[model samples]
Target: MALPRTAPSSWMQSLDLPSQLFETGSTDYELYEEDDEFVLSVELPGFDPEEITASWDDGVLDIAAEHDDQQRGERRTYHRRFRFPKSVADEEITAEYTNGILEVRLPVEEAVVSGREIEIES
Candidate 1:
């Protein structure tokens, strides 16, 4: 005999089930410093370039996207903010979206680490 389908538990129903289940893994975005610039690449599969926006304020870079499908009655949104370790030239920042991937490049100002290296105990 087959088991009958039942409703979810009260606690489960109260959770953001869809988001938790459908969200991408932590590896969906990559950030790194290279060639005097901070590079960020994020995978946003279902959104179009027109629906995506990127902005820099102070030391934070904000990336957001929204998509709406009237026929399917569905809406999706993505938002993320990143703070760079070094000063960024906000005016030189640039972004590009292609092949469902959004790439943002932030030119970092002259930032050199000046600290003493601590010896580790064997």
Candidate 2:
């Protein structure tokens, strides 16, 4: 006889490897709001420093990393996109990775007008 399925007691508790610790399509991360900055922490195991990259455009933050073992014929990748708050300085965002963890610091700044009035030529 088959046992009935039961709901998980926790949001992030599971027996599966890797998947239990992070989402399937992207890496796992935690967001924190501080008095001066917004912190974003991401877990990227088995990735090298050169393989990682980060960028921001139009208030959207994008992070990605990839590694390949040619002899082992294995490839691993992580990609995540975060829409930063309008109150934060998207252009000033910075990131650092250590011990398989990536921490991004985004200092909040007053919103400034990025547009300027243009004069039309006759």
Candidate 3:
């Protein structure tokens, strides 16, 4: 008789070894409203500004960074699991990195106004 096979636990399935061993962990992020735009700040240490990439699509904002192979030598192993939320936008977004921090500015779209005015019947 063969023993039954069991599914892996949620925690076990979410682990990414490559990211944990070599890749740095995901940076902390903060979002705030600024005037007519939303500002997002992410704390990324030991990361180059040119190595980061960010984009938004289908209500999800994707952020990814890969260390330079030539500059940093061979890719190191990682053991981390990170899941970033996607942005819900049809157009592409832009990001900037500076002082070990990444700042993203998103412009708020103006709300549409309906032309129909309700009249009171006395």
Candidate 4:
């Protein structure tokens, strides 16, 4: 999902209104699993690395940023959360911000599937 510079009201979102009404500066992001790890990359321009914060808690990944432009008397904030289907090695999670992009790597724990495949009868 893309992150907007500012989000619409929760009530508006719950109503399922047209997204055009909520249009704003968009921050592109991608999430995928590769080589037993989940990788997430987000585009966040005009923000310094010191202003961004990433946190992982209880299977959820939270990314947030705040920029206060004292000269322009403007403030920008961003926040998003993601959850993984499989267990993640939170302790080993790592993130890096460079060139207006933030990337997070989450190591997925080994999973054991123990269900037999069902036979379909025509």
lDDT of candidate model 3 versus the reference: 0.59
Encode model 4's per-residue lDDT on 1-122: one tens digit a residue.
76655555654677788976665565479999999999999998999999999998899999999999999999999899998889998889999999999999999987878899999999
Q: What C-alpha lDDT, on a 0 to 100 scale, does residue 91 get in candidate 1?
A: 90
TM-score of each: 0.71, 0.67, 0.56, 0.71
In model 4, what is the error at residue 70, expressed in angstroms? Answer: 0.5
* Clashing pairs for predicted structure model 1, backbone only: none
Off by over 4 Å in 3: 1-27, 68-94
Candidate 3 Cα RMSD after full superposition onto the native fold (Å): 7.2
Off by over 4 Å in 4: 1-27, 112-122
RMSD of 2: 9.0
Candidate with better TM-score, 2 vs 4? 4
Per-residue CA lDDT of model 2 for 1-122, tens digit only, reads 75436544333345555554554455379988887898999999889889999888777779999999899999998888998755677677889999999899999897577888999999
Model 2 ranges with Cα > 4 A deviation = 1-27, 111-122
In model 1, the worst 10-residue window by lDDT is 3-12
lDDT of each: 0.86, 0.82, 0.59, 0.89
Ranking by lDDT: 4, 1, 2, 3
Spell out the clash pairs found in candidate 4. none
The true-versus-predicted C-alpha distance at residue 103 of model 1, in Å, is 0.3
| Candidate 2: residue pairs that collide | none
Best candidate according to lDDT: 4
**Candidate 2 colliding pairs, count:** 0
